[model samples]
Target: MNWDRIEGNWKQMTGSVKEQWGDLTDDEIQQAEGNREKLAGKIQERYGIEKDEAERQIDAFAAKH
Candidate 1:
């Protein structure tokens, strides 16, 4: 989904985000606020992955749910 849709439906989407990035807390997801860069950045930081890889994982997670 697009960033706007994700932001608008954050309450519903956060669970999926958390499920995908299990290291992320509810507070971290809340801090993300559906910003693509923030989520990807956090994933990269937590998982020690490249930015592109982090984005791909997030996109896959979003697609799954």
Candidate 2:
């Protein structure tokens, strides 16, 4: 669940991310570039959720991956 590992494997992770947050466009995910904060922010924007909630979901997603 390391951000560094995700960042290093951003391209590979994109598909899973998209699968989890289907509302997000590819361009938005690309903009994240594997930064946890950016991805969380996007999830917040798309899902109308709080930042912490977004982080929690991302944490869970990363945990499974």
Candidate 3:
């Protein structure tokens, strides 16, 4: 899905995101608020992964949800 769609549906998409990244806290997810870059950055911070890898993960997640 596109970022716009994801953002529009953020409230509903939270569970799916949580399922993918259970290590993320509620506050962190709320902070992301469905912005792709913010979510990627948070994922990078939480998982200690490279920014590119986090973006790739988010791309895959966008495909799924």
**Per-candidate local distance difference test:** 0.82, 0.93, 0.92
Could you report the Cα RMSD, in angstroms, for every candidate shown? Answer: 1.4, 0.8, 0.7
State the displacement of the C-alpha of residue 59, model 2, in Å, after optimal TM-score superposition. Answer: 0.4
Per-residue lDDT tens digits of candidate 1, residues 1-65? 66678778988988778778899878878888888889888888888999989988877776665
Error of 3 at 57 (Å): 0.3
In the range 1-65, model 3's lDDT, one tens digit per residue, is 88799999999999999999999999999999889899998999999999999999988998887
User: Which candidate should be chosen as best, given TM-score against the real structure?
Assistant: 3
Q: Worst lDDT window (10 residues) for model 1?
A: 56-65
| Candidate 2 segments exceeding 4 Å error | none
Which whole-number lDDT from 0 to 100 does residue 59 have in model 3? Answer: 86
> CA shift at 48, candidate 3, in angstroms?
0.1
Error of 2 at 20 (Å): 0.6
